[model samples]
Target chain A: MSDHQPSQKELPEAPSTAPTPAGISRRGFLKGAGITAAGTALLEGVQGFSREAVASTPKGVKEFGPEPFPVTLHINGKEHALQIEPRTTLADALRIQLNMTGTKVSCDRGVCSSCTVLLDRMPVNSCMTLAIDAVGHHVTTIEGISTDEQMHPLQAAFVRHDAMQCGFCTPGMVMSCVSLLEKNPHPTEADVRYAVSGNLCRCGTYPKVFAATLDAASQLARKA
Target chain B: MNSFTLADCSTVEAALSQLKDGAIVKAGGVDLLDRMKNGTDTPTRLVNIRNISTLRGIHSTPQGLTIGALTTLAEVADDPTIRTQYTLLADACGHAATPHIRNMATLGGNLLQQLQCWYYRSAEFQCLRKGKELCFAFSGLNQYHAIMDYGGCPSVAPSSGAVALLALDASVELTSAAKGKRIVTIRDFYLQPDANPHRFHVMAADELLTAIHIPKPAPGTRSAYQKYGEKESHDWAIADAGILLEMDSNLCRRAVVAMGAASPVVRRSHEAEAALTGKPITHETARAAGQASMTGAMPLSMNAYKVQLFPVAIYRTILLAAGQMDRDPSAAG
Candidate 1:
């Protein structure tokens, strides 16, 4: 292949520990080059370089391809191993890899809370979190919140109050509400609003969602 | 999203080493991931610094408050000391983003968040901040652009933490292998768009923001933050003010008033602070201070609404900080 050609070629196969013309090993070159090239390319547009020029671009840099790597995720109380690219978000890993579709992915840019899930018991946008980053963290999706036999109080209240319209944002809303209730058992209406502010229900289920969350909070308080 | 390698750094040293080796750092991954997906940023290797234990807590000392950079926004909003002693900071953090975002976004990440200008965030527009010759917001849809003229890029700084820190006079501790450690005041931390349109703050690529130092305020110091948005929740501020005042009886001894979203950088209105100092914070003085805060403000075609809203936000923050306003600022409007 021509050095300046921008063809989508596979990464050259070589020993991971074998050093290139530069002192750094092939693995080190791949790691460093992928990062440096991307970082610089973000500010300065990507440049066309020959293969030799790319290899000799820096001492410890080499380009990377879209290859999958082994990743172990601790979802709820279970551990699941999957092969995914670095671009795969925790939400995709849960929904696609593990088949835990309870966590939705609306506005995957972290604006909407449809992908909200508990990471170490704290509500986070699963779509914005990388699966590799959640390696050791405990992840709890809406499916984990309720067992096969019994539904969580928040889930039950969501159904009782008819909090959802199209039911698209229900899982995320439930996750956020449950997280809030866990932290503050007696949250005010304003608190509920603030807790789920990230979630957007196009069906205009605000009033119903707030009602269900308040009812669930009261029920949990009574149980305690 | 562009494919990248993940470098899980176990310690601060390890993270710094990766950074030195040209790896971009990821903490909460909230803004970074979004930017990556949008093609605004394409970091190939992300050095996960979330595991750096030393950068993860809020500590109070006799001198002041030391907040670790990795401390999540949720922790900052919920911490008792931050809530009571530095209500402005707490309120700013709480009002920023959403519950899920707050749980993930770290203080350091929040401070370095890029401008939220639609044109800038979008990949199609190669604005001045994106190394283009001209800014699209300069003539295109500019309803949400900066009102205050900072020259060059017109996007406003999108950090609520920066506004609060400016009001509180906080300093950030930046550490790098080459420079060791140094402190930069919040005022000096941010650069004007005219000076460096591409860069947001003065933080170097190899340096890490380890912590923020907020000096203990004088006795009887009261602070508050008030922002005006279209929605009551989950909306960026059209105009916002963070005020810190040292009250002696009814008169103000010292005042620091910082405004955000109205300007390209978190700006402290010295004129507004001067209007309130040594004077009783009555309705008339507060109103004057509000008007004074917008001195020399030059708004764009669509952002003139920010000029009107800035005064209201400033006035409301002053009233709340002085204990004159008892209700939430949002309710006041």
Candidate 2:
């Protein structure tokens, strides 16, 4: 995927009558409104919380937002510094702030693995993690799984096996498989199934996911 | 989720000092973030305790094992010593949520998680557990509600770690800035519905769960955990059992049977434990123990199936712990 922000013209227009708050751009408001053509962000938007500062605590505890604070996130082996609210989740920070939109946020809650990302090489739901909490940690998104020139072996295997149907779950599924193969280079069918168990595919492409993950394991083993 | 100040604390003292009214301690932020997102809890500040290195390991002493509260479920589930000795806790942690969740969720977060009732979880309903007047589960969709020991609330206990810890006779260390520290058994850790429907546990707003202490299981102890969910992956246990049996060859000398997703809180079945304490490990005895477990269980309207499920869960889990039978093929979930 290209590292470019989608233009305002590119976004589907669901002209909202609701008042857009200041400091939040129209594109940000529309995106936060969760208007998607493919019915992707149907459940909850990445920035679902109210942005208005309600209350403030004492100053001695080293507090950061109710207002935008300086936060430097190390995503995909690169450092990107941005000012974001403390309530902004890692998923929203990646998609809305840094425009690393490869990490999708279908269900902003932690139940769905659509926002799966690697924090210090461990797969976790980025939607549940605060962007500030990700400081001093190595964050890897689906875009960072492979080099610019080539796809990861797991990604290649997914393409070879046609592992996705609706394709919404492909990124998260690939990230989970990549995490599994990194830990266990040779995974069985059950192992692969368990690895991607959290990543739900509404189209039910689980069999292909299992097959692709195992195939990638063998391919990596051969390379080794 | 509301906008809150983030206090990133590196030391336990710093985390403890930051704790105040309306300030929440965040270990892994798995359950806390879920509660905040659901509008169940709105904290003015999140005291980040994840950076406290001293609160993130498992240590063994001469008497027992101590597990730091910040230790992830994945670490507890994969620990070699826990796998061999505390098999019940290992199995419970291993089968929780998912691989990704196990990697991110902490022991303290799972143990302190709120009920899984849809009414309480959703912001739309003002259920009794949330200090409201009515419990919608009493009249609404309650196919997965509690079938036993539900008073005013049919919401079931949702923690697998609590169930296993109760069976293992574990104690939790709660530390506070003002009150210092106090240790309480896992059985006494939870507050029953009758005690207080508003709060799940007795921990104060200013306190933090520091560590878990599990006394060494007696010699000849065998244990196992069995959980039955509607789905095999990433679902809470519909009915779960954790059994610890101290056996002398084939005769059961002592037993601790704790159940989850069956009651408002993870509870030990004294009747079931009494039935198995002196009996020989056999299918018939296991069935009798299972029967004893459901002595006073009163099911709600749609959850009568749980009445049938709990006994079978207890029966098969007992057999599993005693090495009398393999895992029931039909109860894979």
lDDT of 1 by residue, B55-149 (tens): 99999988899999999988999899988989999989988888788889999999988889998898888888888788888788888888775
Candidate 1 global Cα RMSD: 10.8
Docking class of 1: acceptable
- How do the residues A83-149 of candidate 1 rate in per-residue lDDT, one tens digit apiece? 7666678987876556565688889888878999999998888999888778778888887787656
Deviating ranges (above 4 Å) for candidate 1: A1-66, B327-333
Report the Cα RMSD per candidate: 10.8, 5.9
Candidate 2: segments with Cα more than 4 A from true spot: A1-61, B329-333
Q: How well is each residue in A94-190 modelled by candidate 2, as lDDT tens digits?
A: 8776667678788777666988999999999999888888988999998887765688988998999999998887888888889988888888897
Report the number of the highest-TM-score candidate: 2
Q: What TM-score is obtained for chain B in each of the predicted models?
A: 0.97, 0.97
